[model samples]
Target chain A: MVDVPQLVEQARQGRPRAVARLISLVEGAAPELREVMATLAPLTGGAYVVGLTGSPGVGKSTTTSALVTAYRKVGKRVGVLAVDPSSPFSGGALLGDRVRMSEHASDPGVYIRSMATRGHLGGLAWAAPQAIRVLDAAGCDVILVETVGVGQSEVEIASQADTSVVLLAPGMGDGIQAAKAGILEIGDVYVVNKADRDGADATARELNHMLGLGESRAPGDWRPPIVKTVAARGEGIDEVVEALEKHRAWMEERGVLARRRLARAAREVETIAVTALRSRIGDLSGDRHLDALAERIVAGDTDPYRAADELVEGLTNGA
Target chain B: MVDVPQLVEQARQGRPRAVARLISLVEGAAPELREVMATLAPLTGGAYVVGLTGSPGVGKSTTTSALVTAYRKVGKRVGVLAVDPSSPFSGGALLGDRVRMSEHASDPGVYIRSMATRGHLGGLAWAAPQAIRVLDAAGCDVILVETVGVGQSEVEIASQADTSVVLLAPGMGDGIQAAKAGILEIGDVYVVNKADRDGADATARELNHMLGLGESRAPGDWRPPIVKTVAARGEGIDEVVEALEKHRAWMEERGVLARRRLARAAREVETIAVTALRSRIGDLSGDRHLDALAERIVAGDTDPYRAADELVEGLTNGA
Candidate 1:
């Protein structure tokens, strides 16, 4: 017996070790995950998920640390999940983020976890929403999911957040890349950190310019406001929080917040379903069936499309 | 009839216009892809696939174009598939590569095509294999798949090629990053492009040291030899080509070449099958089924894991 109910209760009581153990179950994709999720499901959905993303070296960790401090000042329990999807050297990079935020470690109200691929289930992003549910159930008033802004991974991260904050630094060429990578579209609030540096105002101007050319949201669509900060010194964080709160209010008023939560739940179910199907695809029967089709296709007896049809058919039939 | 057979014939006759149209079909992911893949299956396995990859701005395009020229000098027809897996900014960046290689555009013996997304389906890498098959059937002696080695996309690129070349530039701090990203493992040949740069040798030395610690292949396994090159000036290309040739021969000798092709084909088939399953997940009767599950999960009537099971089951049960 894994004692999911007891652990969930302990987690609700803000026991750090219990929270860590529960998240570890999510990371490990242990068999008991179903029970844990079932146990924690009713208690979730209260915490606000704010996603912070930026190109590496853009001071995302520092900005996130600053945000945590500001939220703590409001007396809100905050949970931080720092996800590093780019590097397999995740341990070192994730450690750096943790060390930067370690000043808050003594406070039990702040629960910080750094996630890398403990095991590759497509990506660590896939496990994130589940871990988020744990934190949400554990009484965190806010949960921040921070990830390196890269290709497809960033899109997944944005999907998980209720309010997405796109961070940048002066002279990183991130403004133009942001427009190109479609980061501008996903962001609800933008921050140009390292505001003390030269070119900071220019970076803000450029991001604002790019946002101007972005897709026009519906008539009442929220405009993303860009704020500059020297996150190194925790300057401008209150404004960042203010913008986040404004966006949260806007999203909720527009029902976009509810839709986003629904979409997140939908994606979570889809990920699990797809993962199950994928795992089922590797059984001895399925492997042989797939290899047989592949052999025929390679031997020119059939094409990939038809073989795929047969394979999908096999999934429901004979084994 | 769309004259797919005639187009295939024209392409095989080495008509650049015809080859370009066929590759366009690949980029568009036209339904005729099945017919084309069946037609090209046997003709593939003739051309050698050399994957050239590195961090962007490391001159991967220059190296690839230089190799195209060297192969053409030997009177061998070559094909280049420039896969821009980065952002939408890929259009301009990839164009630069094509323009540089356009010097040979009139030769008729070289085929260069760039594949950027017409849409988002996570099928960017999937299209490359089919395109490679088209090039093989079109009588190219060598088909180079060039991609920006940023993250998981690079790994996918490596898996598609028979000989994977890892390119680096001095001062990119890429040597260590490469090790962290697991780039050091997939490479069959390594090149330090822009060897004339101040820190080139030091980069080479560091790469060699990392490679030294890398796992040894079988006793007779081919060691991925590191070669330095000034691709912009077309220097050291002959050695790069030689190393590629040597690796190809070694792979063939060890039967690794056959296994790799088999794996590639298997992956292609699996990608199609999985894509089919994924597509079946969110539409028609399936949409309602999933929404119902999602609603229940959101309401805590059931957990995501259980809802996922019901959804997967519903996928096979209904239309």
Candidate 2:
């Protein structure tokens, strides 16, 4: 309804309200959000997208809040998309993360948005990335995307970001297994949050040991830096920020940035493709042809792949 | 390649080897697994599908192993599908779950197979239920679907099972958040897996308090029983088994089982529809027309929904 392009331009000029309005529009309104995103896509890739993810009570939000506040201290505008997983039935936060993070509400230099993983099968998918784009286009220097917790979805959040931080806590035994299952591969920097807690050192040592066992993909020996932080108290916050910068430098020095950029483009293309495919599929509603195929497949009359192939050929060949 | 129908008949006749082979075939060969499932669908609803999921290192495998051994002691032939998150690179277990579970390998009364979460985005999907079906058709009195550590993917496992048991450890801080995420709602039974730990009682109390906050969905005070167990030592194993049986009865008596069947059927149908649609779009893989539309959508000249409509209409009208 609003002059979105004009508002986008205003946001590009660093208007905080315009930025906030743009993010809200992009997140809550899907169709309109896509329209705004189309206008803003070219303006993206400017902000360094940093993803921070960990288990619940691992102080991810607290760490991210500290990071936002820290970046602001250095005169860098920051945008935080704190992804929250809500009770799907009740539509309420188990922990009101957004409300707890309301301390930054008055700081114009800092923009924080709490995103409830709405309607999507997983938290922080379509809407979350689009929201980041809005912030990125709005002239934010750093865009922090925080996930609800560590899991497969958390790894996804890492994939979308320019730099991925896997947060770990003390006392979770066999943390190595958690790391080995795709988490270790995704992290550019590992933060042992709540460092004041006992066993944090041991967790860090275990992570370093595990990191040693794995082969590094990046050239020039890019070991993911492990930083210790008590995010709630803002202790060791500067080191975490420095580690992020150092990781970026390492990537740049090794020419991994170019590779990362190419990967990002491919990912961007794939994300749009998958989204378009899903949306197109939704339009089929309940086609009798599809239902029959399902029955045949379920009845052992046909294989799923073969049935899939038939459906594809039939549709594509102008059935 | 073995005679699936014959094997199904043997499983129905309560042959454990035949049941084990049936599950193995499903696990190793998914395409053939579907063929086998189609043959076995009408034969389902015979075995109770029980899912065990929680955070890693919380003794889920041990608990499952104990449960399977207990059920066997009671003369019940049990089938165990331990779903391990397969390494995306190595295509093997991140942890040696199967090795830990290999105790039942030589036992005639038990069938234990570790399944890798192949190509599944998170915790477990399609494969979990498909494997369960093989066991059910093979006429196992109890089918235990064991999932590695809790996260978003873990939630999917709950929906797949008739009775879901959520395992929790004593030291995992803020156990309440796990409960608050509606895990409490899905769990038919709750197990404190490592009761020897210091905080086990606290975790149990937290679970009970969380459960108490939710309104009872079942009739006549059907509160999910919370059983404490040191699964490694097999302590409280009988209580866990009793809890599962009691929960299953509650489901049947309250007509929840029938409703669950309908829900699962609907879910399976939806999955088939989506997979079919994905394949159809996939067929247009090299076509310039779809790619051009994607570019337009990405360029903001067309909205995703309208693009979807165009795609559907194009397919229907022979573009």
Candidate 3:
């Protein structure tokens, strides 16, 4: 008996509590999700999404705070979603991260939420896209999707952004490690954070070298530019922002942005359908339907592939 | 044309090349996968799956090598699948890991294959289960599935294991860190590798103390035991193996093994169905049918959720 219109109205007005509640509903897979999305749909596509990701301890939080400050200076409303599946950082380092970003805590123009995707069925793969939708519809002018860790999460986060920023620190080793980890592939703008350190120039040089070695770009193709920033002091952030703007412009001019949005739309639709199908499977799995199939497989009466087809067929036909 | 039964037959004989080819077919989503799996299904259920995972530098490779040697000494044919996402470590560190156990590398009783799940759709998440089936069908008495990195991959690996061994080392901080990472929840048996290092006993004591604080076990409930080992020296590996065997026996006696296998079967079938549906969506999404829906979304004609339903409905009904 939730009033979807009222909640959507409040979220459109940038009420933090309403926005949080909307996200919770999305996370919980509430029955009213599609209706809610439909209400919020027309209001979206305004916010500029920037995804920041890198290895742990690479000053991602500091950089995010600096970028928030920079954007707020221009009078832009901001939303931040910090995704951490490891969950350790969410408690302590998160507190420290917020403490540093607390200057804007009461601004109301800024919204911040931490997402721990562990132990959840859809995890970040599903919840993040919906969360982004909520933020976009809530009238945030700019949304920052930040992810931590060195694994596939980086690529996944980068895929969600209109512009992706990959940050690295000096003395954390060379750009070769980042290349090896596939960070280089996703970066739209590379930042050498903590640039005051001794190896900053070296790190920047290494990154430039690697960027040069990439599948030889045509003359007009956008090469990921390296920006040097000591995010702690908020130095050189303008250059980072400039690079993001450049990439956005490039994507738009090439009609890549339109295609990207179309692809994102298609992907989101597919995911929603898949998630609904999975839920159907879960519901049908009750009452021993799935248990019977599993028992047959365990008894060697049928293989899993044939059994899966049977289950899918049974569920589809009955529905 | 693919000879599914012949390939499965060669794989069942424990031929390494045939095993590699079978896994490749699975990774590539070969058209004959269902047939191949059907042929191999009856030959499975004999191998004991042990999943080894932890944070980097915790000596998982060494511990796995030690376990392999211990099992080999007892005349068990072992299948080792090292899941390195990029396939880099399998050649270098894998050799180092097997240095002590190299004596058995030349023995026909041992089978080792490294799985690089990167660049494949669903990657290790989907491919590992099928590869485990291959190893299981190949008549390996014990199959060790080893994975690297932290985060979602850890949980996926744990789900595939009958026995999940979470390896740790001294100076990696306290059990609190592991608990924070959700590792403590899924571990069937805990091993503190590099026991010769300083604070080894302290690490063990801390782990034991933490394990004691977990949900109180009944008189017969299996509590995960902490075993200390200098894996490089192969010290205490026998104890680790003993603990694994004891846990297996306890699970069997309590009928948990049957329940676990049944659950595994159900999950595998569900994953296969979901994967198949996803491929169907991927195929249907091509040719701008999805693009038209996305254009409507971009133009605010509809929301993504509704568009997804339309796409799913069109595909499902047409099929």
Per-model interface RMSD values are 2.0, 6.1, 1.8
CAPRI band for model 2: incorrect
Q: Which pairs clash in the backbone of model 3?
A: none
- Candidate 1 positional error at B173, Å: 2.2
Give the fraction of reference interface contacts each candidate recovers. Answer: 0.52, 0.10, 0.67
DockQ result, candidate 1: 0.56
> What TM-score would chain B of candidate 1 score versus the native chain B?
0.92
Candidate of highest TM-score: 1
Candidate 2 shows a clash count of 2
Off by over 4 Å in 1: A85-100, A179-182, A213-219, A284-287, B85-90, B94-99, B177-182, B213-218, B284-286
In candidate 2, position B35 carries an lDDT of 64
lDDT tens readout by residue for model 2, A70-175 = 8988999888777744311112433454555566767777777767654652235656666777887788899888775545555676666888988888986536
Kindly give the stretch of ten consecutive residues in candidate 3 chain B with the minimal lDDT sum. Answer: B84-93
lDDT tens per residue, model 2, B33-111: 6667667866776778888777555777778878888988889888877674531111254345556556676777677
**Residue A97 error, candidate 1, Å:** 6.2
Over the full model, what C-alpha lDDT does candidate 2 score relative to the true structure? 0.69
Q: How do all models score by TM-score?
A: 0.93, 0.79, 0.92
TM-score (chain B) for model 3? 0.91
